[model samples]
Target: MADNADRAGEIIENRLEGMLGAIALPPRTFAEPICVDCDGEIPAARRQAAPWCVTCAPCQSIRERGSRR
Candidate 1:
């Protein structure tokens, strides 16, 4: 029934919200305009996307790949 389905959806939504609330979220942060690793300009879009980034996209990708080994 439509009512039963709606009630089920509500229950699921409530449980998800509770779980999310219990989880810790990272603190908001800002980063320097220049990339620490490459000494390049950190793009405005990149800073907006990840305000905590210390490196530009290329440097960040390289670092992540190197760390995977």
Candidate 2:
């Protein structure tokens, strides 16, 4: 039934939210001056805009692609 399906969906969504909340999130290190990936010096403007960037743009893109697997 549609009502049953809706309820099931809500339950699944809540469970997923709880699981995500339980996982430890990486600490915010955007205020750090160095890139964790390539050791490139992060520009002040970029750091201000994205306070949690750990890699330069190119390195970050590569890391993202790898994580998709």
Candidate 3:
């Protein structure tokens, strides 16, 4: 019974990890330099660090909320 529980827990953990991975957006690429929405200039450092960023922090929050629906 203990072994069975451990196996079950492992399976659950793996599935949860997979689901979280699916929801996670890939990091930004360095190719793009501007925000698609507001046309705001993305800083060079930010582009390098978070290349997948489409909007600034404030706009991103708004976009995320809309996406949830």
Which candidate number has the best lDDT?
A: 1
What are the runs in model 3 whose C-alpha is more than 4 Å off? 1-29
Model 1, span 1-69: residue lDDT tens: 579889999999999999999998655665679999989999988887788889999999999999999
Candidates' TM-scores? Answer: 0.61, 0.50, 0.46
RMSD of each: 3.3, 5.1, 4.9
The alpha-carbon lDDT assigned to residue 36 of candidate 3 equals 79
- For TM-score, candidate 2 versus 3, the one ahead is 2
lDDT of 3 by residue, 1-69 (tens): 579889999999999999998896775558377777888877788777887776666677889899999
Clashes of each: 0, 1, 3
| Error in Å for residue 36 of model 3 | 0.4
lDDT of each: 0.89, 0.81, 0.79
Model 3 weakest lDDT span, ten residues long: 24-33
lDDT of 2 at 62: 90
lDDT by residue (1-69, candidate 2, tens digit) is 579889999999999999999998656555677888889887888777787776777788999999999
Candidate number achieving the greatest TM-score relative to the actual structure:
1
Q: Sort the candidates on lDDT, descending order.
A: 1, 2, 3
Q: What's the C-alpha lDDT at position 42 in model 2?
A: 76
Report the Cα lDDT for candidate 1: 0.89
Better of 1 and 2 by TM-score: 1
